[model samples]
Target: MTDHESAGTPPGTEPAPAADGSPAGPAGRFLARIALGARHLAAGLRHILTTGHQSDEEIRRTLVLRQLEAHDAVRDTAREELDAVRRRITRLELAGAEEGWTPEQRQQVRMLREERRRREAAARDMGRVPFVPVQPTADQIRRARHKGSTVRLLGLLAFLAALSWLLVQRPALLAPAALAALIWLWWSGGHPPVLAQRPVPDRLLARPELDPDAAPAALTAAPGQDDDQDQDTDLRHVTTADEATARIAAALAKRKVHVRSVAPAVRTAYGWQADLTLREGTVADVVAVLRRLDTDFRVGTGRTLAEGSTDDSAIVTLRVLTSDPFANPPAPPVRPPLSCSILDPVSDIVSLDGEPTPLYLAGTSVLAVAVMGGGKSSLVRDLADYVTACRDAVAVDIDPTGRGLGPLRRAALRTAYTPEAAEAELRRLLAEARRRTADLGETEDVWQVTPTTPAIVAFLDEYAQLTPEGKGLAIEVLRIARKARISLVVCTQDATADVMGDAVADVFPIRVLMPCRKADIGVTLWPSAVSEGWTAHHLTPGDDHAPHDAGRCFIWAPGHKRPILRYVPHIAPHDALQRAQERLDAGLPTLTATDGPQAAQAAAQPIVAVMLDAFAAAGAEELTVAELLDALAAVDPGHWTQWDTRPDRLAMGGREIKRALKDAGLPPVPTVRSKLPGRPSAYRLQDLKSALDETG
Candidate 1:
């Protein structure tokens, strides 16, 4: 036998004597044991209350079941033992009453009778184990609170009614009586009532072992349930942590990397996250294995996900895509007009795993590169729509082929269809940037664009076709990206470094790589892009030989971990035109001839000469200032800002021409009286001709 059985002591019951053979202080030893036991008891209670599934509720059910079983076991045992003692007592009584009994027989019968009586008294003296439940149900708690509140309210009402009667019957005695009662009540409740204390149990009370036959009815379920559970089908294949770990191990083993162990998997909002330690592999090796896993597992790339450590461990967060996102796309986001800055997400919302794709266009320049029919122009068109609708931003599109900015023409301040026109527009924008710098004070780095100081966004499609002049203009424009507040969105079919040289390419921090014919284009645009999983070469184009139609591409924007897939929205032509017209009708500022050099030339011409030419062209003898300004604006909108149509203000667009009559050697603008009241400014064509002939 072990030492414990020989000592007649149960395990963990008491500490043994010291080597010196002196008994340890029993009080100190008992107290120490009690403290340790109390700590463990408290910890167990806390775990029961918080750790298990449906912890509080499950704990309640488990405790109730255990209590019922214990009560039944103890009661049944006591009843059976008592019954046996009673039978023995009856036999002793019958023997004592018999005739011709010997003295020894009588003595033996008395001893048996004494023993039976002692056993009966002991059984009666054993106290009962009362059952007290904990954690009342929600309904029980609610009902208790309601009942207590109702009782208090009824008592208060009764006291109030009694006080009213007393006040009417004996007003003099009521105040004193009420004061004395309040004082008594306050004094009684001020000190907490003392509770009688009982000695804590020296040893923890454990429930008696329950008999299987006395188990609670609820514990004895229908026999077929177990068989049903065993036969139930689990379609997920991977249900437990062990199963998921096994799948990951198998995937890694295929790449010749053995997984030593998998950490406890966590269920994230997207999918499961697990840390994997390899027996012999580097982080790069792990990443390569994950890339292979993508073919079968569909996990994100290393740069975007799959973080690794130097200790040959990696954390791969993966989610299996059950269906294609494109096939069942979400409703496209509403297109809001651009405000002070140009940041807006112009695409249907899409997320990686659970992280939504971020597309912010403000405070940055962009470059879009793709082969022909690769949705490059479609992206530009979407951008142009945003730039046009902005109150303080001007949309200037330079599509040398004339087809790119069709829907944007009505909204744009200027649209160029020739290399010379685009070049001239770029030069004018560069000049505006300088002017803005002077206006804002050279010390200020960023242009605080406002109604008066508007931002200029120049969208140049087919950038590869730019002449030397346009290229020079592009370089200058790109140089003032952040400081001057000039944002250029340059797109091209050719993604070669030669087409967008180092100087230009370096400024475009937000590079969009749409589908391209060659994989090398991604490397050309960004050298490290290939390693970052910029796989534009693998993108499948849409049917009818169109590349994604709109928005689909890989975007490498600022602050992203790596390149992410996105689709640019395709705004219908009618919708774009309607929005632009709404802006015009709202009297918001539109693009003017001053936005580009070609339009600025018209402004440089003598205002009076332009006025005379307008009347000559119209073949009119007389015209109003409004008519002349309208004619000039229609002919060259780049040079002329739209006239303010506010009823409270005088016309400002034609004010300059009205003042320029004297400079052209003509009479001052004369006022023509209106039928209602005020005289409006008007000019005569014949007088302007006579004055021009005299000046000549």
Candidate 2:
């Protein structure tokens, strides 16, 4: 059995044990160490409630009160232990006959209610919130709380013993053990994280396992070195750790390699991972001054992810030196260019930022979950610059608030807004995702993207706007998050904890939090982020995730432990819109865009998407032409005067529709020859058809 499984390590997390197969791998061991504290507390609590061994009643009661205040295991927390004790008391009273309520029951409930009032009053006086954390952390976390364990154990045993002494004890008194076990399981079960499955050994995926004598591709005691290797060859047939390490030592030995000792490297499904620590040496020396003994070791470089504070750093990388390695994945597309109208700014990334912030995770996708204006809009704008145009790429925006493609109009295969629009676009993207997963799972040997084509990105902006529209986007985001091909950049201003309910929100395993105004904290943080009166200015955005300026962004790639601020190369949003128009004008085939005949309609009355509201107020009747003209004259006299009087639909032509459809990404529809089948041409704007529908 793996170290994690045998140690009762939580599933999906790395094993926890020392090197040589001890009971802790980093993944399992860290959690175990963390979990160990809880076990001790629980044991202590059980002893207190059941043992009845209190030397001093006042001291014991005070201990219970403080324990309740510090204890975090229960569903609800309290400054007074009475809150939890009352709950237990209430449970006991309810389950047992009302006659069971002793003087203790009434006292516990009274104290509990008193504490509740204190907390409630405290909450009422709080101020506005400042930001949102997609990643939820324990608000009341402490060094290590062992309060409940002892209090509960002693308390429970005392209750049982008291009942037995009273001559009314029942066999059910033993039920405490069962309850403690369940609670322990719950507390412990939550300790570990789920990690990606370990990749098959190179020998397993390639050559068949041979006998002890035969050894072409089996998990050999040591994999052999290769002289003429293909650039795209799998690591299984390439090299080994011993071979790579010697090169590393030779490269930096002269400077006094303060190597902390390299542990046995384990291969993952996507790549290999091992820890590296430097005592006296710096990262620059490892990269620049280190001379190459064998070209293989020097060929690979280190990649790190730094976040929260600039002072902290972790070494992460994908190396080409080892042969029995994880399968290499296609590099994710860089951020695509923004609108041609917007000037793209250079990023201080390579210099100011010490580590590379990869947009995509191999065998894992990225998740961006934040309340809006926290720089999500600009971040999407920046991502437009990360991806290349050739991966048959496209982006669809489900929001109808005019951010159809955000600033991604230039490189997105196509872009769209509105659920009706997003639905059509998602169907196509989802289809492709399903196709790749089933067809290329083995042949392409990739768990995610293809190298030659741009992967489709369906970014939903202002997702909360459609909550009233019932598009089920909340759930859809989660489904797409775990799948292949498509990556989601989801943005919303809604701070509701259970947006669209659980089904949809639960799927989004990854989340991103953004800067918020303290006043809006109550609405945004839900039960999360308890601060109030916080402002967007407090959030830092950068490649390593600091506070945001104009071009900065933050990322939380999978496998990363925290959010990172990043320097996103600035791309103009308007220019992105222009390029999207250009691509549409070029008749580029795309799934969706501001390009189809829909573009004309999309562009004609910017207010049309707002429907009659833009036409008038929130609610209005179907008005006559005169009323519309009057309204237009009040807001836009110039257009009102220019509008033709012909009620038979103004004579419109391709120029209007072509301009609109250019960004819709679909080709302009053929011109309409007749007003209706077998009917003569009606007096209408010939240009309107192009303006209205692509092929109408």
| lDDT tens per residue, model 2, 380-403 | 665544432333444544554656
Could you estimate the TM-score for every candidate? 0.46, 0.35
Alpha-carbon runs more than 4 Å astray in model 2: 1-354, 361-373, 388-392, 438-454, 467-470, 480-483, 498-506, 517-537, 540-554, 563-569, 574-696
lDDT comparing candidate 2 with the true structure: 0.39
Model 1: worst 10 consecutive residues (lDDT sum):
203-212
Cα deviation of 292 in candidate 2 (Å)? 51
What's every prediction's RMSD, in angstroms? 33.8, 24.5
Scored by TM-score, the top model is: 1
Please give the lDDT score for candidate 1: 0.54
TM-score of candidate 2 relative to the true fold:
0.35
Candidates' C-alpha lDDT: 0.54, 0.39
